[model samples]
Target: MNQTQILVIGRHPEILATVIRLVNNNPAWNATGCITDEEAMSTFDKQTFAMVLLGGGIEEPSEDKLCAYFTSRNPDIKIVQHYGGGSGLLSAEIYEALE
Candidate 1:
């Protein structure tokens, strides 16, 4: 079976570390973490990833551009916008819509 891959984008060290732990532990995703939209985009452009977990708590321009760039490059790629703070608050709406 092909392993699923994900790109995680966020600036919060603590939160990012938590996500890295969660993702690394999950059998479903081979997750890679990035600190900025630039790093995320650079990595994305170089290889194929099954999903992107965009830190919704990040700054506007960076988030917007990353979303737009990813959408434009691979419209099929799944994105999970993580609204850092609480786990229960994460939006499934975007995931559902993509499905």
Candidate 2:
């Protein structure tokens, strides 16, 4: 099976790490976490991702910009807003986004 590439954008290091770990738990998914907009953009340019999870820690304007950037680059890319939740919720949200 092809692993789905997921980009996680957040300002909090712990949250980012946790989300990355959660997403990576699924063998079908590979996740990359970025703490800054610049890093996110650079990573986005370097690879093709199936989805992007914008963490609650990001500022509203930054999140909006990142969503716009991702959609503009690939209209089919799925963008999901992720507030901190349990592993089950995270998995559900990711699965929903993929569908």
Candidate 3:
């Protein structure tokens, strides 16, 4: 099965881990979490991501850079801002983005 690759970027390690865990729980999704801009860029470069979930705590500057980079790489890439929500909301956000 071809799983949907998701790039999860957050400033907080705990939040990043939790987001990754929740995303990966679904058989259709696979998440790669990063806590730093460098790490996120590196991972994103090495892997093809269908969607990017920007978690809480990310600085506006960093988010802009990442979004620009992602857009440059894949103009059609789906990007979502996820902050302080339950797994249900997260799932809904992702599903909505996919549409």
Candidate 4:
């Protein structure tokens, strides 16, 4: 089976690193981390991602716009929410559903 590709939008280096590690550690994911919304959007426009991780610090308007754009472009992509510091953003059920 092919691993799912994930795009992460976050500012903090530590949080991005942790998320990259988590997603990469999972046998099912191919994680790629981006710091800025522009970079994330650029990546999104270039390639298809199975999921996207949105950091709490990210501007909701920009994130929402991106989500809408990506969903319109490809409805199969899932957007998962996350906090800036670490985990616990989504409930286990939501996480499992996103996964």
Candidate 5:
């Protein structure tokens, strides 16, 4: 079966790890986490993701830059600002984006 692709970016490694774990829990989804904008962009350029999860620790400037870069690459891309919520909210956000 094919799985949905998701790119997650967070400033904190621990938070990013948690997000990655939660995202990977879903059998139908696959996620990649990055702690830096450059890494995120580099990963993004290598593959296509249906959605992007931005962590709370990300700065406004970085967020703007990332969003701009992603939008430039895929205007229809889905971007979500995730603030360390439980798995339920994360799933809901992902489901909502796919909807």
Candidate 6:
């Protein structure tokens, strides 16, 4: 079985770690976390991610740019904003986006 690759972008280390852990809990999913837009863009260039999750720690303008970057690269890529919800909500959002 192939797992879905998820790229999580956030400025906070703790939140990024939590999001990575939650996404990886499901066997069908794999996740990578980036602390800055530069890191995220670099990783995105090297990877084929199915989705990108923008965490609450990222500012509005940065998030917008990241979203634009990813979407421009892959027009159909799924990008979702995450605002520190529980693991369940996070999981649900991810699955929904993938679906």
Which of the two candidates, 3 or 5, achieves a greater lDDT against the reference? 5
TM per candidate comes to: 0.79, 0.96, 0.97, 0.79, 0.97, 0.97
For candidate 5, lDDT tens digit of each residue in 1-99? Answer: 999999999988988898899999999999999999999999999998999999888989999999999999999999999886699999998999899
Comparing 1 with 6 on lDDT, the higher-scoring candidate is 6
The runs of at least 3 residues in candidate 6 whose Cα sits more than 4 Å from the true structure, single-residue gaps closed, are none
Better of 1 and 6 by TM-score: 6
Better of 3 and 4 by TM-score: 3
**By TM-score, how accurate is candidate 5?**
0.97
Ranking by lDDT: 5, 3, 2, 6, 4, 1
Clashes of 6: 0
Task: Evaluate model 2: give its lDDT.
Answer: 0.92
lDDT by residue for model 4 (32-67), tens: 889987788889989878788786677778878878
Tens digits of per-residue lDDT for model 6 on 5-93? 99998888988898899999999999999998999999999999999988887888898889889999999999998897799999999
Clashes of each: 0, 0, 0, 0, 0, 0
The 10 consecutive residues of candidate 1 with the worst lDDT sum are 88-97
10 residues in a row with least lDDT, candidate 6: 55-64
Q: After superposing candidate 5, which stretches have Cα over 4 Å from the reference?
A: none
| Model 3 agreement with the true structure over 1-99: per-residue lDDT tens digits | 999999999888888888899999999999999988999888989999999999989889999999999899999999999996799999999999998
Error of 6 at 1 (Å): 1.2
What lDDT does each candidate get?
0.75, 0.92, 0.93, 0.75, 0.93, 0.92
TM-score of 6: 0.97
Candidate 5, residue 6: the lDDT equals: 97
Q: Each candidate's root-mean-square deviation in Å? A: 2.8, 0.7, 0.7, 2.7, 0.6, 0.7
Model 1's C-alpha root-mean-square deviation from the true structure amounts to: 2.8
Tens digit of per-residue lDDT, candidate 2, span 1-99: 999999999898998899999999999999999999999999999999999998887888888888888899999999999897789999999999999
